[model samples]
Target: MSEKNRQGKRTARERLAEEREKQKSAEKRRRVLIVGASVVCVLGLAAVIGVVAANVGKDDGSESAGPVVVPSGAKGKDSLAIPVGKESAKSTLTVWEDFRCPACKAFETAYRPVIHELTNSGQLKVDYHLATIIDGNMGGTGSRTAANAAACAQDAGKFTAYHDVLFDNQPEETDDAFAENSKVIELAAKVDGLDTPAFRTCVEKGTHNSWVDKSAAAFRNGGFTGTPTVILDGKNIYQDQTMTPAKLKQLVQEAAKG
Candidate 1:
């Protein structure tokens, strides 16, 4: 078998143990696992390139379906409800990611328009599943820190806002940590009526940590070992450099038609 297939044969526990040897914490290991998984990943679907939307929370005025329901207690967004399309949308595209990852940053930037096109036009719905499985020390805290800030952002219903800011000002994980660093507090400050104090305190104490950490654990359990891992209507979309906006849109549209 090929190297990818060779690696794929290992169970999550086996891969996780190996990843832990490389990273450390189960959280970080999980992030590493995801990155590893995304490289080859449980494969399926087409590849596209482009920008997508990043909104927060639920909207009452919009027609079609309701809000995206998060199983582990839905969180908040910085600005508006995460810019989702139809709540009851037949086609749901969910992303399991770590904010600190560089690849995820690229994917988010590329996915913006695609998500907008699909959701805004009411053809699809998307929800973000935070996994701070990786640490900043690797490529940056794009994994953990971003996930934490996202949780705080979600608390204030500013997840999408914080998400954009996090990507816009992504710092070097090795040089500066965003996950447990002061930047998270600063980001929390930017959101109006966001209970910054509570968010800061919560993050510091890890009050809402379970959501991010547990999700990372779930990612591990779900057979997804990576950041920016996209699940399209229960199907895994595995693409490395090829996972562009056009590709995501194509899969979503094709899935919708099916």
Candidate 2:
């Protein structure tokens, strides 16, 4: 073979090797960019979740008297419960719930009427503790916002009606739709004479946000986990897996008999 032909072949091999190395380098850079972008996106989402969880329960440091959703017939003005029936009732029923929780909606649907009947008949008075556990778990402000709106409704003396309506119109657990102020106002209309401008302004300004935070804090401090937590005579009977609304009413009646 001629020397010139051998030289040309060597140069050709060198060029092909250089081209392959260039291609490999480009692919490596592309892979690195893709992985880096994915990691950044994940970190950003996590940061947002943390911020929302922290801010949802923030104390705004206002000394304003909290929402007055307690019924005219209720007792204990200083506590978190909006009482129904006489304070002299034989039984006290405490319920802890998050408006955004599906399980709570199920519990509400099953037990609301029974509870109403008992309260109306003067057999029991209920203490409602609103919680924002779903907000912490799901990483959004929907639960907190909804709780705040309910507090505002409490100021209108429509806590029970607005409370029931909130559960009735509860969005899917994963959705943050309740975080919108308008939605709560819309739900307030379901309660007769509840959608007043004062209620609207209170909800829009998050006037009860701090109170909602306090209530949520009480729930956490109460050492109970999860929503739809029901306590009858200071006992956690709803923890039983088989307990139903009918069973709950019977238990309340039985407790009253004691």
Candidate 3:
């Protein structure tokens, strides 16, 4: 073949190879773009699902469907509170907590002694409000079931004992172990006279589920946003950044003085 023809053929072959390489690179770029968009869309959908699941039991001004069985000493607008101090006490400390909340467990473990001292000394009256926001966020019946069992303990006149045990034995945040009625009853056995057949029946049948629902509703409607929400003399101490367990005592004493 002529040298000119040979050179032209070689150049054409090289050009063809370059064209194929460019096409492959363009196809690879298109695939990458498609994969990235798909990933973003999937993440967006997952985020939406998470938000919806977290708000499943949120209070929307709607009442509970079941009958709300308020405990004997329950107080509050919807009768969903358990009071733990003398009526004549000057300081009112309101606590909103969820049994499944790790933060609530931390607060309870850290401040239980001071809380007991104040309540025992009649220097403070604490109103305990149970919330099940964990159940809403984590997708389990454990929060509701545990709250109902606590109410049942109140019926048996053992709220404080059972309440202490519940926090002491709080499972991992995502663990739905508390959802089992048998497990709740077993925990009740830790509190004297709290494991009675009546209490068992109350928990097994979820007699106070409505009250738990109402408590959650009251929590949301009370303009609170999270667990371990501590309020003293109508002031939200949890909102204060410098407030510690010691500061809590001072705040309560000051409130009592007023």
Candidate 4:
């Protein structure tokens, strides 16, 4: 090969290597920039989450620290249960529920008719213990707030109707609509004579917040796993996959016969 051609070839190889090195450097810089941006975004999201968590914690602390005020006609230990039937009924259903819990709403929707029938017929009584587990799990005060409002309804002698209203109008699990007292009071309008000034004051003041908190503590301490912990005559009937509203009515009827 000619010397000039050889020299030209060597120079060309050097230029090619330099070009490849520049491309690699550019790619490395680009990757670093992308990683840095991703980290920044992650940190920003974490900060926002932290703020939200802190705010929720503060709200929970303030609301749950009040004096325990039991609603009128509340029964059971420490007045934690809101009874929804005649005390003389043969079958008693003990229900632990959270208003914001979708499963609890589902249970209420499915069994409401049967329960109302049994209660009205004086064949069965239900002791509803409200819990705020959804608030603890989902990071909001909707569960606690709604439970307080229900307690206020109990004070107004309209618990069952107001309770049904709450379940009927339950928002999405993640939606904290019930955390606002106004929203809760708005729902009370659906129940006859439940939107009085006394009820509104009780709800707005969170009069039963401490009671609801205590009930939630009881639920947690009772070794229960989830909401809608339905117990019929000391049996956790809710765990029975074969259980249905008709089956529940049958069981209650059998208990009444016994």
- Which is the leading candidate under TM-score? 4
Q: Encode model 2's per-residue lDDT on 8-101: one tens digit a residue.
A: 9999999999999999999999999998765444222334334334434342222335553332333343456766566877899888888887
Q: In model 2, how large is the Cα lDDT of residue 129?
A: 76
Sorting all predicted structures by lDDT, with the top scorer first, yields: 4, 3, 2, 1
| Model 3, span 48-139: residue lDDT tens | 32443355456333346577789879997777779998888888888998888776776776678988998998888989999877776777
lDDT of 1 by residue, 49-94 (tens): 1111111111011121233223223633421123345776778777
- Model 4, 156-194: lDDT tens digits are 889999999999999988899999999999998888888
Looking at model 3, the pairs that clash are: none
Look at candidate 2 and give me any clashing residue pairs: 69-154
Q: What is the TM-score (0 to 1) of candidate 4? A: 0.76
Residue pairs with colliding backbones in model 4 are none
Q: Considering TM-score, which of the candidate structures 2 and 3 is the better prediction for this target?
A: 3
Better of 1 and 3 by TM-score: 3
Estimated TM-score for each candidate: 0.58, 0.69, 0.74, 0.76
